[model samples]
Target: MEELVLYGTLAAAGASGPRNPQKMKSGQQNHNNSSIVVCDLHSGTPYQTFKNVSLPRGSTLQAVHATSDRVFSVQHNSSVLLVYHWGRDSAVQTIVLPEKLAVVKVSPSGNWLIGGAQTGRIYIWEVMSGNLVAVREKHYQEVTVIEFGRDDDSFVFTGSKDSTVLGWRLYDLVNSGECQPVYSWNKVHSLEITGVRLGYGLRNVYTSSLDNTLRCWDLERNELVSTYILPEKIKAIAMDPSERAVYAGLINGDIIIVNRYKLNPTTGMVEGPKGNNEKVTLTYQDNSDILLTRPDSDTKASVTCLDISFDGTVLAAGYSDGQAYTWDITTKQVLRKLAPQKEAVSSIQIVSRSRKVIPGGIKLTGNNSNMLAKKKNDTSAEIFKLPIFKRILDEKEIENHNVWVKLADAPKQEVDDLAQVKVKMAKFLHEPRFIASAKVSKSNVAALTGRVKELEAQLQRAKDLKQAKEMM
Candidate 1:
């Protein structure tokens, strides 16, 4: 059993999803540890959990949003936004805003991040630098939802509790640093807007509101395309890839499927089959044409959030009672169910890519500055100790002495005794090599005199020998 426990710990540490452009397959922020849990969709297993992530004081983890390789979470009633990357135990970046945030979203290209505050302000940031690109006070109440343009990252749509939805060009927001909304629709809903989604071609923006209506607006013309009135309050909405269906999660714990191409109320159903067409109008507590009914665990719990998988084949729904269900979109069968927390599940996201494990942990640690400081400290103790002014004086004096020595052999002009004394004094400052060379020359002269005396003595000895030979 001890060995098994160790094995499980190791598996949890290394078992990650994929490292592609899509950062996560599915993720949620649960009550346990107030952490973000990433799960593998194929295996329906928990891949990794980010723990002890930093949030604002007195705040809980309210939402989890992801970019290509980073996961961001916003805190409830707090201005702090926690950023999580692979292999990090704590938030790598904590972006603090002026006010507390209620919702957050990352762009499809992973270049921008946006957070909506309860103060009716939306803050936009460039992801790479964490620079605040723009802040707009476009809503009168709390901002509820922020969504990127599905076709491209050029535009972003936001819905607010003020019952308005505004669209803005991302380029203008970052470049001009202005909070202007390019397109504005006032009082689109009679109540607070809960969720917003942009179509694949960006031709329509779908929004659900507390007023119990799913409204679609055309982007190019900035006009209403259609409205599907539901019986119960719509809490969240998600669209499939084909743009053929829009799924609405209701407050009564029911999921409703609305055909995207069909069911225009003003005009009769025209494009789709007659049998497929259902009544576009809904009454209170109606589940007659619901797509997915409530599970036994979440019988009357409000569906708080909903997400569609990348392939549009799976639907993941989170409930206020903390039940999370994954369903096959085609068969409307529950594939898996989980309850990670006893509290409400604030958000749910379904992505396509696997997990990314960032090697060597965090990339920012003041390492360069630390190395520079160490190098400075090591060299500060060993100074050159150079003689400053005194050394320059010594060099100048030596140069003068050298000039005196070089002029020693020149013809001496007639001068006074005092001048001659000054000349000798100047010569005294010359290098010692002059005195050394003079002593060496005198020693050679004495050696030559001794050799001559020895030669004379030898010549006298030879003469004395010659006289003795003559006497014989």
Candidate 2:
């Protein structure tokens, strides 16, 4: 397998990608190798093929910091995703996952995408193509959540409503034409999974279940390492850039911040020997600390979607009431907001990609409308001086910022409740049977301990109002 490794990395990555379409034409190339599709959001909406694709091209996002009268943020730009336009007011892809999209992760380099479908299938898509690159159906009840291991191996791991979290090598799933579970939990959770996220570098897997708690697993050892009990059912989970503690959003509109008390991210290890596999240590305790938060400070709005930029400059939360707000992570204050949709946001991502808009550059000529002409008439009428024509053009331009997405109405899970669900899964991890299964390496365990301290410092800065910035 390693023999062809050089070929996969160096040769086809660029330069010869399209011309040597020989591999794709042969139909034998694994979907894992490539998936490429592009769309024009405006003119080709109805005729587009892929249903799950959408792009934010040519559209302007409502600037959250702007006034209501401003038109730039009202409409969006054209995107390559599947766009079904019933009219001017309609153009968003809708997909109903078999269960709920437990976890939707776009690859770091943007080559591939992965998400767990409610049908207990691990859905893999090619990024630009919006194609179902591959599908791994291995779960029984439903695939509640999934994460791609952040290691060089690039494996896929999933947590299920059946109370199980299983790991699999990606290439194995691609070549074997079937999903073979590496680890299975007869009872991973008492309820459904609502929140889940893989650790930054794949040292751990964290999940929140309907059972009202969060669970952290040691993937290498296949054991439950620690658990966190939140104030309410966990709804969303986002790790700090440092991977210290995670900010979990709950159904009750509260976010619980779980601290490692002692763990490390850099080395992927726990400091103390806090385990049950013939191991004993001082901090046998689980969950160093849990802090409650409200991703959305508004009293009435429930968070529908949440995302943090890679640099942690913006923390955006989409509401069930059809509003999206950006907050200052450091100061914890709302910087800008938009009420764009009437429906809850199925997903929210602080993507760096943006649509480009070019104006028509048309000029208007009128008898009674021009302010420049009024001065020439010697009547100097200030009543007709409002630059009405220019305003009309401005509004026309504002409402026309046609934003398009690349995904279509293809089915997937509704991960809207993920953060809260992982919290419940935490309890199951705390269970003795599960604890006995974890592989806590001395270095792995020690690494986790150190990362905890590093993350604590970051979270403290985020909580202390020393952080939070406006996003572009």
Candidate 3:
């Protein structure tokens, strides 16, 4: 099992104070030599760092995705996908993939796990059984990113470095092992695809590529609705909670925010011309841009990944130089900037959903219990008991005995009445044993009084006899 890594805890954010390069070396454990730091976004500071996690000796950490209960991480050049409880060093499970994975994602429901491999074969595993349910070989190059539809886990989206984006129906993959995508667009980007996102109700899927294009697709109609070609290569993207807008992080360390399509209230579809609208011209917007470099600084760090809070109030962007910034999405102002580390921040995840915190500070949510229950039921041990032996009897005796036993086995009410009677009778018989300890009776008093009277009469007679002897 790989050593477990946790990024955040419920502790005070300033427990470790600001990030220190000297303390960074001490923050890691001796056995595992790296740390996964947890930060409290509410306090905007570092909370805790876990270092005891075991990883493949020479492999580097890849992407990290977490639900309310568990944190899932993958490693480069390693086939094992390590799972850890939120804010703990103990690994709950390790899933072995068919091939080394470059990217991994868990459904919002946490019932599914998908690992994208370098060979373009995507492995899908059912979280309940931890079994590989399907292996999809749709992309020709490395699968760069994969995401589940926000509405549910039934739909999955994948983008490959081969410059294509495909939408897969999970039901078909699990039921029939179908590798062909239900919705697909080939060579949508001129360069490698970097990020893929399922916008809002999953009706719109977004893709960002190195060719400097952000394409939006209408998955329901399988048509490209809009495309925003940028000035620089885009590395990462995140959608707001309301699905009103999307933020794109570019290689130039600039964060670009773009508005998404509006939905029709009655039809619950994109509020545009319906059906075969592929001939419709695409709309491109380019006014939103926020630069990361300070006024006094000349160096610019490339934005590597982006994540928005559950409420869409804050936006977190990770840069190529390991620096990270959190901005208030409404005001478009920087909230906090974390110190730089040695490696680039490949992914950013904001802990959002509220969870029931159990004693000892562990989360006792439904997902954690389900994971434990699955592990217990998947074991193959069978229980066995020795059979009892009985002696054979003659038919006549057996008949007589069986008849008596059946007759004695009366109704439950009658059995209960008989038990009460037996208890009363036992109490009545035992009353005699306690007779000596009972209170004194009238007969015992009368017997003592008679004995006293007899002694007094004897004393009077002796007195009379002594007087007669004196007179003689």
Query: TM-score winner among the candidates?
Result: 1
Better of 2 and 3 by lDDT: 3
Clashes of 3: 5
Residues 330-355 of candidate 2: C-alpha lDDT, one tens digit per residue: 66556555434433443444433223
- TM-score-based ranking: 1, 3, 2
**Clash count list over all predictions:** 4, 97, 5
**Global Cα lDDT for candidate 2:** 0.44
Q: Candidates ranked by lDDT, best first?
A: 1, 3, 2
lDDT of 3 by residue, 76-166 (tens): 4345555655445544444444556777788877667777778888776656544455677888998888888776888888888788888
Which stretch of 10 consecutive residues in model 1 shows the poorest summed lDDT? 1-10
Alpha carbon lDDT of residue 232, candidate 2?
Answer: 63
Candidate 1 residue-wise lDDT at 152: 76
lDDT of model 1 at position 378: 45
* Number of the candidate with higher lDDT, 1 or 3: 1
Q: Which residue runs of candidate 1 sit more than 4 Å off their true CA positions? A: 1-33, 53-62, 87-89, 177-179, 262-279, 283-289, 354-356, 359-364, 367-472
Residue by residue across 1-472, what tens digits does model 1's lDDT show?
A: 0000000001121223122312211122212234455666545666666664323221111256765456676654345555666445555544444556777787887666777777777776655443454677778887778888765788888888788888888887656434678788775689888888887878778888988998777778777777788878998888987778889998888888886665668787557423221335755455455568865834688887788876788888877665777888888888877535545666777655434344433234332211111123243221111011110113333234321111123555799999989999889757597767556577888999999999999999999999999999
